[model samples]
Target chain A: MRTDLLRRVEDRLRSLLAAERDLWSGVHEGAVVPIDALAELIASGGKRIRPAFCVTGYLAAGGDPDDPGIVSAGAALEMLHLSALVHDDVLDDSGTRRGVPTVHTKYTQLHGSRGWQGESRRYGEGVALLVGDLALVYSGELMAEAPRSVVPEWNRLRSEVMIGQYMDVHAAAEFSVDPRTSRLIARIKSGRYTIHRPLVVGASAAGRGDLAPAFEEYGEAVGEAFQLRDDLLDAFGDSADTGKPTGLDFTQHKMTPLLGWAMQRDEHIQALITEPGHTPDEVRRRLLETGVPDDVERHIGGLVERGCKAIADAPVDEVWRTELADMARRVAYRTS
Target chain B: MRTDLLRRVEDRLRSLLAAERDLWSGVHEGAVVPIDALAELIASGGKRIRPAFCVTGYLAAGGDPDDPGIVSAGAALEMLHLSALVHDDVLDDSGTRRGVPTVHTKYTQLHGSRGWQGESRRYGEGVALLVGDLALVYSGELMAEAPRSVVPEWNRLRSEVMIGQYMDVHAAAEFSVDPRTSRLIARIKSGRYTIHRPLVVGASAAGRGDLAPAFEEYGEAVGEAFQLRDDLLDAFGDSADTGKPTGLDFTQHKMTPLLGWAMQRDEHIQALITEPGHTPDEVRRRLLETGVPDDVERHIGGLVERGCKAIADAPVDEVWRTELADMARRVAYRTS
Candidate 1:
């Protein structure tokens, strides 16, 4: 069931994607350069985690494989996640993603090749923004096509994710940061959307009853663990493994695990953050130099372990436990 | 009848908004920075073109509001439209909207007061993105809740809008500027999504019989007129009247009615675009110094007149005719 589960999800996703392709039929035909490139980039190897989560959540809630609603909802979630990645890459000025040149980078190269100046950055970002919007619209459309009822979860999920994202950005802007605040930010930003809501949405769509509290508890714990794992990867992970630049979060002065730990133990970490004239890389290294301190690392390690354990021990069905166990282990030990 | 129509629509919108508000009940207290901001901004402003068109299309297709499925389907279109606006502001980097600070601008100001460096911009965009996402999800939820029969149209509408957005962005990235291409961009980017699909969705949702072709014809004509008017306004409209930054499209070298004309006529315009080195304003002034040629303006004026007339002449009900007539007149001569 476990091995077949991935195959099932991937097959459904492939078929859904073919249907979704019609959404951009004109542009894909018109401009062979950017539109086609973007489409290809989107369909390129994605973990499809959002879709998988949707599908998994549905199955865990006793949904049937033949249920077309699962396919639509899963596809919608995947589109939303992809859309966010497109926009986020532009915002972060990232040049590569998932081991390939990012959409902005490809467009920038195309613009340069065509000698289109001034609009290189603007065009890249603008096109990326539009692509993101398109994905967003399509996601909704796909979900709307689902056979099951989706109103209640769909309505609330939209608002919650947005609010959480806002909170994430706002918290990052703070010059003075603390652990409690950072945790709060993480919860809003990831906890509800990635784990909590997806599960609830899947369950609700499948007509499962009273699954909320279990999903909620598991989501919060595992969500925090997921974020904590991400922070570690950002600071210490191999770029080859993560497909992202190392030390990015630290360099950007993003308040994350390494900095949070350093700040708690030493005043010097504050000086490093407060001081001007340091490159993002320099700050990241400085924060790391204050050292994860065996005790601090241990603490973060404990939190992640505890969080994962809580998820594993939740009252969810055995499938959840099995699925979450793998995720937890990966989170705990993976370099990225 | 018109008064009642407006009141009923308004009341339905209020109820929808209320339902949406409740969706965020526990997680979103104290989140309404301007208590009536979204409601007022959406309610009192613009033509309720999307919703009305959707309803009209639904009715034309022999669908009925009295049919349990039509209401949510109609409302979903509105929610999707609302969500698009939230994200659009961020993409446009807009400040004021509907005679007030946009969502991003409002949030940015909130961060600025807190001494958050780069906080305002980041926070604003983040919040806006979140809000847009929320709208996207809610739109799906509404569709799912609606009577399941109209699902096909809802799905098609969703996909069409996204494709339209991608085309808009793709056209903006072009190095070679052509009037024809620009027109196509305008149609796909703004026309179909703004007018065509909304009308079709409305008629479809209402299950009106044999109205598809009429909606298409009416939507295409009106959509073109709407976009043409927008192009004229961008170039000639007073900032005070338009409530938008003057010459923004020109500065961005965006393909619009004004620039599209210039791009087609002059080699210098092509050179200016191809190798833009000077500031955007300098280029704008230089282009303007070539002056608004009577022939060029006349050409643009001709297109606008044709579009407006087409919309006015399209076969539809008396109520729609009057509305289209008023819109055409307003679009044809309005400064903004």
Candidate 2:
């Protein structure tokens, strides 16, 4: 059921975009550019984690496969994430995403090479901004196809993520290190947006909102684990595997919960992050020396355990419960 | 009726932001920053053109005021316009909006002055990007409160505007002057999004989809006139009344329908816009010498007449018909 739903979501995304491309291509040749950007990003692919959780939650709650709302809902989640990625890449000046030149990077070069009218950076970033807006609008269009019950959660989820992202940017700029702030960012951006809300949105789609409490608990724990692992991957993971540059968090001086925890223990980490001319490798080697990586690893394990335990007695089908546990482990331990 | 509805829309917008601010401030002090930006923009107002058109559309269609959905739809249109304005300011690099420093300008200074960790430009632009995103999300939230029947038109209106803006940006970059492309962009961005779709959404909220045809015709004609006046305002109007720097279109090399028409008759205007070191005064003087501004004034009068005539025989109440005619004149001929 999960695999089928995932396929359906994938199909919906491709065909919807293809249809948009077809329609806009006739309007003006340039109208298709942003739609094409969206299509390329989708094809380049990420983990599809949000959609997976959404569909899995729907199936685990025994939703009817024929309802069709879940498919659109899942697709909407992925599209929303795409918008965030496009805009976030601009914020981070991330040059590449999913192994492809990011929208801004590609367009910036296009403008620079062509000697376009305005500032090349502005033109490129502006194209990317509009493309992201298109994606956000498209996400809403898809979500409108879902059941009305999803509205409240969907609204809350989107606003929470944006606000959390604002705070994340603010924290990074300030080079802040507060566990309370970091935890709040993680809870809103990762715990809820990525994991908890998707699960509840799915279950609610299936008319089983009673599972929200358990889903929320499990989602928060496992989502934090997911985010910690993300920070680890950003710090030390292979660029080849991740398809994005490593140690961007360090370079951007992002106060990741992982980094915040490390900063609490090692004074030098702050200097390494905030001070220029210090390489990511310097920060990575320093991070290793701080012994905080091991602590993070241990915390991730505990969070995964707590997450699994949260759903242990839930009334989900036993098979699905076991699958959820496996999903937790995969999310926590996956390298990329 | 329109006045009361507009007031309700204004109240809805203020209370909604206040509530969001209250909720986010509890999470983190900095989290309320974006919400505050939105509130400030809304407070330092423009004409509230979109909301006025929306509520006017609903009232003209003989929709009942107590229904409440029209108010939210009106507010949604305004919120969506705010999102566009925020992003458009970034795209245009306009330092000021509504006679105050723009979000990017203000944040960029903060980042520069405080010596933020990342590039100040990136940090400032990023904050503005996220704040714009928050407005987009909030627009969706408000639209959700409206009747579901408004969704299709709402969706179409948003995608049209974004894509139209994309094409506009591309046209400016390419410095293209095709009349067809300019008119198409104008129709999509202004005719539909600014006037027609909001009205349709309003009427649809009241279950008056039947009024769409008249609204469409009136909107397209008046919207074009409205856009030409916008170009004129940018080229020649006072910033004190408009609350924004004039001649941004000239500097950005925007291929407005007004410019496209003028260029067809005059050969030298293109160089005036495309080349650097030419002041807005030069462009304005050159534009006047081309005798195009006079043609534009004549064209705007004709379009406004066309707009009012299109709805003259519609089923709308006689009083409302006169009000809408007055709105078209106000939109097309106002100093700002």
Best by DockQ: 2
Can you tell me which runs of candidate 2 are displaced by over 4 Å?
A: none
Give the runs in model 1 whose Cα sits over 4 Å from its true position: A15-28, A31-39, A42-46, A277-320, B1-44, B58-95, B101-115, B118-163, B173-175, B257-335
Docking class of predicted structure 2: high
Chain A agreement with the truth for model 1, given as TM-score: 0.84
Task: Flag clash pairs in model 2.
Answer: none
Residue B208 error, candidate 2, Å: 1.7
Q: Is the docking of candidate 1 incorrect, acceptable, medium or high quality?
A: acceptable
Cα lDDT tens digits for candidate 2, B1-336: 778889999999999999998987877888899999999999998889999988888878778898778888889999999999999989988899998999999999999999877788888888889989989998998998898989989988998899999999999998877999998988898889888888888888878999999999999999999898999998899999899999889888899987888888887888888877888888888888888899889999999999999999989989989999999999999997
**Candidate 1 residue-wise lDDT, B210-271, digit = tens:** 45665566566666666766766666567788767765665555676567676666557756
DockQ of each: 0.43, 0.88
Give the TM-score (vs. native) of candidate 2.
0.99
How well is each residue in A1-336 modelled by candidate 1, as lDDT tens digits? 434555654565456556555544544566333335445755677666556566666777777777667777776777677777876776556777878888777766777788653556655665676666666666666666665555566656665665555555555667466766576667766666677777777877778747777677766766666676677777667888887787666545567655776777676766656567656566556656676735445654665566556656555688677786666456455564
RMSDs, each prediction?
Answer: 4.6, 1.1
